[model samples]
Target chain A: MATMHTPQIVETNHPGHWKKSVKTGLKYIPLLILIFFFTFPLVFMIVSSFKRDNLQIFADLRSMRAFLPVGELTLDNYRAVFINSNFPRYLMNSIGLTIVTILLAMLVNSMAAYALSRLKWRGQKLALSVIIATLIIPGQAVIMPMLLLVASLPAISFEGGVIALTQGWLDTYYVQVIPFVTSAFSIFLFYQFFQDIPKELDEAALVDGANRFQIYYRIIVPMSGPVFASVAILTFISSWNAFLWPIMTVQSDNLRPVMVGLLFFFQRDVQWAEVMAYTTMITIPVLLFFFLFQSAFVKSVATSGLKG
Target chain B: MTAPTVPIEKSEGKPKKERQIIVGLLMAAPAFLLMILFLVTPFFGGIYFSFTNQRLIAATETEVVGFRNYTRLLSLSVLPLEPVVDETTGQPVLDETGELTYPRSREITRDEENYPQYAGLTEWFTFDVGDTRYVVLAGDPNFYRSIVNNFFFAIVVIPLQTGLALLLALLVNQGLRGQTFFRTMYFAPVVTSMVVVSIVWKFLYDPNNGLINEMISTLTFGAVGPINWLGNPSIAMWAIIIMSVWQGVGMQMMLFIAGLQQIPGSLYEATSIDGANTWQEFRHITLPGLRNVMVFIFLTITIAAFQLFDQVFVMTNGGPDNATTTTVFHMYREGFREQKIGYASAIAVIFFLIIVGINLIQRYAVKEKEA
Candidate 1:
């Protein structure tokens, strides 16, 4: 995970280094203590997640008491979530949505970016500006209107507005994935990076009889893999974690994503243990994905000046 | 380059510009269309509906009336949104404009008569709670209490959350051991479902058997026994705020860490050699180094906090006598719960304006300072 640091910063010793070090060290204590203070809640949550029952957790939730206790180790809760509940399906649903959205987003955003940044077109700046402006407008403001649009689509629509769609937009896979495919931020991210890439390659490709699509597909997209990975990681996390919009739209139990499924499962007149198991399972994929590619993605962002 | 499909005319015009523009439009068309249809159109429609009495559901048609929604929601004398402020003037607990911010709502407790005018409006809107004629009015006294309460939360929690995030960032960025683990742990909640967080926290804040109150009872001082974390209207806001900070600290911390990582070590060393103390070094070096990050994080956090909805939706529902109701939640209630879409749209519009204004002020402040 280590990367090259600015050389001058590598030598931190100063002439008054000892006295400054003392002060810095002194300052670190209170700061560290405060970090512990703020992080105590998370500490409690993780500890509680392992408990076999509530009594152990309640006994010493804040302290490390519960975690240390020789409580009965049980897989009952995890079993309940994995077998007794819809958690698996929800996980699949979430993964499906996230993967679909990620692929769709990369294609749409990169293509849009290629057009905006690499294509020497008049109004390229205008297109770029529009993409940036999209960032300013909050999504909540238009949710209701967006709901109407979702409900009114052709194949997705219900009969004569008599009801919501039959195989309606409600709970349909496309319904969940379609509205989210185009990300303004991703477009802007790639657009900025593409602008940095030399355009002479484009002229050469054009001279070699390459059509616009080939130039983008063969050259630009391949060269921009690092950023594409970063944007993909971000989109996957967001899609997996998204709660509100999905909850408001998706109605069928079969189509429920992990987050909502976990909510319902936890509230199932069941134990917190099962809930923890559900949460742990839901977190597994993202945790695995994050740990795997985070270094490469972070490097791309740092070098490219793309702020999340 | 096929020598330009139409070599001569294309060569004269360099037609690359027009073709590129066409490709740009085609590539972006879907997203552009969605933004307009889903975002901009609904916003304008929401404003229009805010003027009428629109209810959800297909069976019912809305009655169109100009300014009636506003007329209906006025807190006093049937007037809506009287500019309210926090008590003990200039406190973050209360905003400069009257409204409950929610995060720092620790300090307000109300007696029944505290907001009599608001009570009258609710009574009028509901056709009497138990037999009095209800009047819908702005500046109504009863609802005003909740407004003040909301301001308290926004002021206290917003800054507390942001400050704590910055602090954690500074600490965690000290080239410490297990840095990655700590960062991931801290960031867990940011990625977890807020509904789950809110529900779990609501259970924790459950007055009698709840962990927080239990801890308080064991403490040596300060009303340690059986404190009503959620039940008491006074303490409910703060209780919610505490949970919120816990739920949200991860994102801000991550952003700050990213910011801190960008700081140059040489600057710190140079300042140290110049014989500056730690605090002075922070003032001159750390603060300045993180200025861009600080501004971005600050503005982002504030905006997110201001639009507090999901947590409130799952946890308090702006309840325990409306102590935790925020501007956004209030708009939600007015539009969806009460079937007053027009009024809610007005609230949403005002909320939108606040967000935009805050962004503008941030932009100006940062630009001017940087210059």
Candidate 2:
């Protein structure tokens, strides 16, 4: 065995190693080309955002300089995006609402999934199947009626210590957060994960005189780190990236998310650099979030097939 | 011990059953309430709204007009009107005011001498009800066009994106250098918002100062002029398709990679021992192993393609002359832009059916293939 391994190591450093190395390197050419294909557009966006003028971007388009931060780069576009728009407000709205939504979703969806997977009761399977079936129904199919529903929903408001009853939930933060708190996809994912946990632990907890909720809170949730991470990342990305719903429901600038705020640039006189800068800014958070929870995100997508 | 155990177990079982029911219902209440309020109610409500004369601005009275919106949006099997003609002209003569007239008389057929102008009508289906004549032309041409556009997007994007994803996944499946870096970089756009992708690609497709045209010019040595990617109606949807494929290919790639990792390495070694070459091994082993994953990717990408809206909204706004107006986009425009809530609801209902139909067919196909 030692002798068999020695020749393989020796051949790598042998006299004709250069030829072997070249062959291996050549195999990666297609991969490099693909990487360039995927990365170049995003690189171009970042580079062009730094360029001062639309003319400058156009002038360098014929060469590799369009993707290189070579000449006349500045933060002027970023400055303009901050000063001339409600981008900061949009960013805050997205971050805050995404956090609130994720927290609520985790609490609510986990409980529901636990019940569906662990508890034995009448009509439990029927309820679980009914929830799963909704996954096939696209949101666009029901968005019209949802719009009408939200428009007529009862709400409560506080103004200067005076509480008033309101009829419509549209144009409110709850409209963005509350309706999405109990998604079928998230519940399904939790159910799949919860099924893997050992049932003997639940039996032990029950014998200890713990209630079902206590068993869940004390035992299952503590052991479900990976699932929570996956669900949190996926939910955060979606809520942050929500565009169509926000546009339909939200009319005020303060309530707009970052994705919808990109349209604010379009409504103005077309400024390509500022648009790129705004997109680049909004994209950085997503990239950061993705890199931080990269494995969990990939695992969630593979196992559950939920898209960000 | 046996006597006490039997009595206690019987006593505990009754309350346990009751408690299980209570606990299950209590835990699941929130999920059921939300789904019922949002998804189930709206699903049936949307279908109901399609049949009504509901306006966006609520009225004191909104009446259910049976099948009128559906007939107006799709084709009507029976149009209860007959042609009005004058004996003097014999050309289905106009009324006294020069209006071409159709009056309620008898159902007419395409075989009739003066069948209402079926000239240049591509979308028509006809069935007879015991010798009463009926010819169907599309009541709404734009809606039909939108459906065609949706299919076109799905047909082109699904295969291309899935193939690209599989190729990428295969490349990085081994213990290659910088494997994690490549995976993360490829998945960057998957995390990024669709709106951002559309905006960036819209800039790239700018006819005058766009990067794509400049690169094309350089590649061809100026033989090809800058193409109006988003401007020309013919190529507009194609531009959107390319951008969408780029934005979405990453998610599929990661999923494929996961699928690839699940295949046991022992099979490849066994194939090699049998003198199988690399291509042969891959063809026989890897492709067959990835069958289920490929079907999943196909179903998902196809469904997403059918729901194409944001890219069109952000990049082209369904224009230069509504070229990229997909079903969802048209529904949005009708509901929000034009405030034709009833008509838009009808579009939504049809869209729901189409999606459900596609998913069911795919599921059946995959099940059959597996069996």
Candidate 3:
């Protein structure tokens, strides 16, 4: 009777453990589905970029082979993207634009935020309010008038070792960078971060005979790394992905950023693999940046969402 | 001691305050000047331009148009269409397809002497009430369609995206292993440029050789598809919406995750003690906790939906039949493509008001809920 009872207990326990495992597996099904749904297109893009040509890319789409790097892969698509098009120029243009914009935006917006949060002066409140009020005006609203304004504005340029004054900012690199540098949103983000920092640090620096600029440089900026990181990431993403303004303002292929460049490439009848390669090339830099600053990016987006 | 120190501090602070003011002014100058130059100037110029006949190239002298652009954009009229009569039977005529035979909409719309209000109005659509078929016409039917499309996009995408984000947040918030991996995977597209996403999806949306159709075909054993995703007018906007949602849902998901983390675990513990199940706890605790986040996400997504342009421009170019033309896309087409800067500025003004209206309504609704 004891032996029979022991066997019965073991038999019941085995089934109960199996049932719990099954339930756990079932709970993960939704997550698995979502992961697949979100990642499949991207995976297909990367995989297809390496495929020999459009024929192989499409042929592989019929099965799970589309997501796998299993076909006759070649460097030809990437070669074509580089050798056959102006992709290299666009890539360099985008890279230079993104780095310059991020640096300038960080410097300009942070200084403004520093003044607003740390210094007490007459008219500061009014200035801050005016800046904040402009936040409601979407970029799309001002774009048309901005085009006209930029078109008639005077620009200084160097031509053949001569300083020449040119009318209109159209089709210029500064046109893209300068207008976006003074972002209200970036200033606000920096202001919020700066305001939370203890003012005692600034006072201590001042007691050490530091001037206002020195206090801001020595005290405020060092303590504000996270916010600076956030601003840089935000600016980098926007400037790198900028489309509407670039497309509207830039007509020269040499001046076009990667986004508008991709549009021009897609508009032309090209092989699917080449398109994929072009997209992959443009996307890798951003993806690498995102991966390195994953937590900061997530935190910035979360904060932005909350504030909105 | 206090009196002496206070006087000494005051004596030292005056010049320091003056110096601080000067420094602050200098520090703030660059950003302020640029804002006034680029943002404030352009904003007012846009409003000013809307009242004048301002072209990009200005082929003629600019003149004040006095609300002509606004009226042209907003004008709509509805006129009842009388059915053609059969002379012999005195009965209303029917077409061979068995629909009511009415006089062509153009004939009535163009008869300016009798129907001056309807002049310049093109037929938007027709509707029937009782036995009367009323033709709805607009001065700029394309603009009206763009507005409708904008609303359709916002209405569909806001709820759909918010719900999906919430669902994803809940799934990832469970403290499961490899949650970071899943989160990173989901966020890959958000980091990618919209242009690249649009181009990639354009290929994926190809009617014949697209992966989406191939997958569907394989799954169903080839019963459906090779369906024209972007080439069909009716399905084009929907295709864009799906792609847009897919591209953007990750950011909202991150927000939802942050909101989820803010909810105290003790509430769930307490609810579970009170015999609350998973659904009960979610409804009572999670939803209420995420109320502020939900309102924020909803407003942002709605604003973004109205600003839809890149995808439409890249994927469909507001076609198969202008089915996907959004307000911003329309503005771009008019302002840049057609060089009708004045008309585009009017669209811009209207777009700005709509955004403000959305923000105000959300604020009012949220306040009401809180009360």
Candidate 4:
């Protein structure tokens, strides 16, 4: 009787284990569905980018075959994007502009933030308040007047190997890069990060005969790598993805960024596959950057939310 | 040693203070200068321009119009339309389609001497109150439409995006295996440029031979349709909203995830010990814990919704009968495309005040909730 009871208990418990595993699997169903929904368009884009033509793209749209890299896959769409358009130039222009903006923004905003948070000065509070107050003014509000102002602002240009004074800053790299370098948001981010560092480090460096500049350079900056990384990534993404300003300011295709270039490409009577290829080309660099610095990217955005 | 040191310090202190002041000024100068040049100046310029007839390329000197631009933008009138009466029968006339017939709205709006306030006004919409049909007139009907579109977008998008973001945050925060992969996949759209996303979605929304319609048709066994997503005025704005939410929900989700992590785990443990279920834990703990994050996200999303231009410009160009026109898009059209700089500046000024008003109200509401 004892042996029969023990076997009965084991038999009941075995199915219970199977049921628990099934319940756990059920929990993942929603997550998997969402992942597929969110990632499908992008995956479809990349997969279709390799197809031979719009005919193939649409033909495969009704089946799982659309997502799979099959049925006459080719790099011709990518080749056509480069050969038929100014995409390569636009890509290069965007990269250069983004790099320059990030570097300048990091340097200038960090210095301002250091002055506000670490150094002793008169009116620092007022200055900081003024800067942060500007955050409420959305860029759209100023864009019209900004266009007029930049159009009339003085700039120097090299013409035929001779330096000449120019009246307008329009249709130039300077118009795109210079006005965006000194961001109030970047300064605020740096100020918040710098405020948490102990002031004793500055005092320690100062007592060792280091100047304020030296303290900022040696102690504060080196200690604030995370914040700097955050600012750089934030600036990189914004500058890379900039559209309204560049479209208004840049007219020359040689100076236009990838966003504007994509717009022009879309407006033309081009094939759908080429459009996908163009978009994929522009998106890869930013995605690669995001994946490489995933944690920093997430942290920056999260902190930005807490800024309010 | 003390006396010598004290004397030396007294001599150095004043100059040191001056030097520090100078250095601080130097450090802050570049950013301040740029801000003043690009931001402060343009802001004031916009305000000043709004009061004048400042064209982009001024053929004539800009004149101070003295609230004319504002009047043009904000003017409105509502009047009851009298249905046309049949001369022989002494009864209200009806059209062949069996609707009450009234005189054209243009005639009344065009009569400047009697309806001076409605001089430039056009018919925006008409509705009936009992037996009377009232027509809403506007100085700029497109502007009114843009405002309505912006509000409609904000109202729909704020709640939908916030709820979805919270759900996603919760899902990913459950310590599930492959959580990182899930989070990354969800966030992939946020990193892509709005231009690219808009274009990609435009293709998907194609009326014929598009993926979305194909899927819908297949699922319904070909009963539903080849819907013209963007070309249809009624559905165009909704299309834009869906794409915008998809593109943006990830950022808010990341914020919520961070907020979720900040909640103490011990609260949940205590709740579980008291026999609290999943729904109860979420309602009591998760919702309250996310209040601040929700407020922040709501305000930001609302502000962004008001500034909806990129997708409209790319996909619709405020087309399909002006259905998707936004304040920013309208301003861009007036200011840049039409060269009506002063009028657009007026729009910009109003847009700025609205944003400021929103921020103030949000701050007050959040503070009240906390208290």
Candidate 5:
């Protein structure tokens, strides 16, 4: 009988020995300084949000000015962002759009991907390959054509014939949010993940007389929470951050999402402080999403096709 | 490759091929139809519209201009390259450094060369081209300046972003104390809305009261030496490049860290036994391991840098003197803002071919070298 080999791990990988085992801080020291530099702007933004809105704020344009006590901090900036502006509307718009898009996209992609990956049919591989190939094409090159698609949808004229089909759809949420809700990356991610699932599970389910849809839903999706979470994170973040397309699509003031609102947050006369406050407000959801799913996100991104 | 004369006789009491097809189509209908209508059609339509005068109207309008736009774009004279010209003495003085060097506001008079220079001097200096007089537009020079600036931005920013990202990734992946926390912080910018970042940085870069100028003045002198960070023709593009690197490096870092994690510890241990120091270890062990990841990072960043629009859109809007207009931004402005959709499409087609060609050559060269 052959003996089984045990995997060996080194003790030096431990954090306690990391500093000691490595004498050249020169190597790691530069990295530390860079991380600090890269992260400082965000830190400064969060901290400054707490500062008093007195002359000290404006006068002390120098970040190194006489330190104001933290106790003197006020909620005035957040107050200004929320109360004085249409920030609440904008917030709702962004959150609603992100949530809807993520759910719709994930459901659609996972179903199609499961069908494509798990179901056996001729040329299925070729179809999946073609879909994946489209991802390499930059979204910008296709934006105008997309604009044309949205524009071609008959106008919202109830009196008209063809335009009547889209009578209320012209400037509705569907036009603004639906165009971008489909993602090739999501489909590809789900396909790769679905393919990795042992075929035995599907076969077992089928042996029990479960239909294809039932197998996908009851067997596959229940086991795919982590991938789902990661996809959800990416989809939400990307959708929330989406700017150009939304700008091109949404015309109604009430319908304008956070990105569009942020675009025109400051009118011709821009106030820098107010803009920062607005920026902080807009990024809150994204920041929260990343904080919650940083690990899962990294893994999902690692698995997502590395091309772009 | 298989012969296609197979018939599926039902074995188990389940749905047949036709039945499966119906169910499959029903299941996949929403996504497939949406993808085809929105994605596939736009692609074909983009190519078609690139050849047609299909700008102002919807898809119904069909006017084919037969390569005229392409010919015009191909024959374009690069907008002249001069920074703001001094009105009194037509000499140009602009900062080429990628740092914050431009002076705040109108501190410079005619005596000081840093005062804005105008490129509209061609009216004064007539060219004898077929005995006709020509007047140059003042803004045209800025366009060419931006194109050059765009190159500088790409060259400098991509390497810097990549290098720092690699360093951070190595550190975090070393299983350092509180690694996840630091990793999270590093990548926070990646997930954050770039528009918000740009807006916030706009305030931060404000020449008058931006936190950046404030910090600099306090650290050095008390004077808030405001830099025209995203304005002034000089350092505008570089400023955008700095912010872009800050927001983007995390992604590259993630890739590098992943790459680093894949390298077997045995190789490093073996190298260490041979007395390879930190630099040597990186150059030999770590670098060789990271070559594939590095190529991916390099090309991805290069392409992303070329498609630089969001920063220019949010921060500069093609700028104090059109100094930050990268190719994509130029294309957008031409097609959408100027309503010269045909001309813009030509630019896009040319750009598409260039990107594809470059990508193929890179892959081919890398493959050959690997072989």
Candidate 6:
């Protein structure tokens, strides 16, 4: 038995094992090719950003040298993007807006979702259905009137360091943040997650003299970490990536988001390398966020129930 | 088992139910109010504004011009669109009313189409009778053109993106090595802004120095001249479409992969036991399994296609003579750029109706499929 075992082990560990390894590797060739196809644009974007100019990019387009980090690499493009453009301001604006939007959205949507899903109320079914129905209403369809509405809506703002009532929401940070805070999709997500939680827990909490709000605050919200994270990430990504509304509303350079600031590069001369560098910078935060919560993102999107 | 009786706890909780109703309303109030203010109001407001001649910076009084904008967009006429110039000045002739007049005749060999001059020269309706062609231009050619472009974009992008996504999902659904890595790579773009994608693609589509043309030239051994991707009107929309598909296929792929996982392995195993080939198994089992997901994806994609704005806005700006102009792009231009709020509102209303119509159809289809 010992002799047989030794021979079997030796055979399994033999140099001829490469054939089986190669066969296994061959199975992944299609997946690898697809990965390359999918990732090449981004890879090219990063690689080409480090290149000197458009001419260099064109010259290296055909060869393996295009993808390699071998060229007249310089920080000049990055320097130009910062020095000549409002990229920093745009980034700050987006970050601030995204944070506030996500926080408010989480609170508001979760509260609403809790009420709709957990609390017993009159017209609860109707309200939930109405909220869900709004998912089908594409933002493009209502943007025109929304523009008009925002333009005419009253706002409170600071003038000369004093609080003042403003007539319109045009060209302001509040306009960017406020309208997006109460998201129906986020609420729907919360509702779905909250519905899955056991009603017995709520009943038990109630029997212990806990109110609905107490149950929600102490029990439900504490337990619903995954859904909260999902909503927060999705909401943050969306608000960060907001383009059209910001463009329509925000005219000032200071309030512009990174997506809008991207156009600043185009309005001037077309510096391909610099533009690429700028795009990479703008894309990095989203990519990092995605990588960090990749599974959560996939899960949230899978359970999103519907899309816009 | 206890006898049927009102529990003392249940009797005491009567006020609690009332309080619950009040609390629920209070909790849901802010979101409901915001939804009304932001979404529902605008929806009705769009319809209201469509009938009025509301300009952004107009000093004049706003008046409801019933059906004028819609008719302006839809009206058509058959006329010989010939310029009347001064004959003595070696040009065509002017009428007695001092306005340029076309010599209108039924016997004219060539029939030119005409529309409201605001619609541009794009509107044309052609009919041929005994080798005499009659071309009639629609009132708002731009609107019609945008609709055409929207339909074209939808028709091309949906199937291509969905098919590519389905293929990726199917491939990755296999228990392959580095599956998560492949998924992450595929889904990376879904997290990025559409504007970023457009900007990157725009750089790639540049006429002289873009990588796309450069790669194409190298692939063909310099036999083909450098193709003007965005510059050429014929290919600009397709360029945008390709980029959109790239950016969007990820989400659809993820959805499909999730759908695939939900499918019971036992079904496939049973089919294989019956000696079913891969294609046969896929057709009978996989396709049917993914029906709901496919329908969902189809609906969302169709809606997205109609709402194609960000990429077009960033890359083409409805440019190269508006060849890539979509419906939303047109609405944006009319409303924001041109400050024609009322006209744009009409477009928005029509777009809403179309979207509703599509969703209803989708719902009916899903229901029918289940039935």
lDDT of each: 0.66, 0.83, 0.88, 0.89, 0.70, 0.83
Model 3 lDDT per residue over B282-301, tens place: 89999999999999899889
Count clashing residue pairs in model 5: 8
TM, every model: 0.78, 0.88, 0.95, 0.95, 0.82, 0.89
What class would a CAPRI assessor give candidate 5's docking? acceptable
Q: What is the lDDT of residue B323 in candidate 5?
A: 76
i-RMS for every candidate: 7.0, 4.3, 5.4, 5.4, 6.1, 5.8
Candidate 2 overall lDDT versus native: 0.83
- Share of true Cα-Cα contacts across chains kept by each model: 0.29, 0.74, 0.79, 0.72, 0.47, 0.74
TM-score winner between 2 and 3, please give it: 3
Which candidate number has the best lDDT? 4
Clashes in model 2: which pairs? Answer: B82-B103
What DockQ does each listed candidate score? 0.28, 0.53, 0.53, 0.51, 0.35, 0.47
In model 3, pairs of residues that clash are: none
Worst 10 residues of 3 chain A by lDDT: A299-308
Clashing pairs in 5: A61-B214, A62-B214, B84-B116, B84-B117, B85-B116, B85-B117, B85-B118, B86-B117
- Cα lDDT tens digits, model 6, A57-105, are 8888878777788878998999999999988888899889999999899
lDDT of 6 by residue, B1-371 (tens): 11232375367877876788788888888888889999899888888889998887778999999998788777766644456456679775656886555544333423334422424333354555543444576657678878889999999988998899999998888887778889999899877778778887887777787777877888899988888888889989999888888888889999999889999999998876676778998999999999989998888888888988888888788878789998999999999999888999999888888899889999999989879
lDDT of 6: 0.83
Candidate 1 residue-pair clash tally: 45
Off by over 4 Å in 4: A1-16, A305-308, B1-11
Q: Candidate 2 on A12-71: residue-level lDDT in tens? A: 778877887787788678778778888888899999899998888888898999899989
Off by over 4 Å in 5: A1-32, A52-54, A63-72, A154-164, A167-170, A268-272, A301-308, B1-15, B57-62, B76-150, B221-225
Tens-digit lDDT track of model 5 for A56-99: 45665554442333446666777777766677897788788888
Candidate 3 lDDT tens digits, A223-288: 899999998888888899899998889899999998888888877846988889899988887788
Q: After superposition, how far is residue B96 of candidate 6 from its true place, in Å?
A: 32
> Of the pair 2 and 3, which is ahead by lDDT?
3
User: For model 4, what is the error of residue A235's alpha carbon versus the real structure, in angstroms, after optimal superposition?
Assistant: 0.9
- TM-score, chain A, per candidate? 0.79, 0.92, 0.92, 0.93, 0.80, 0.91
How would you encode candidate 4's per-residue C-alpha lDDT over A90-113 as one tens digit per residue? Answer: 989998999999999999999999
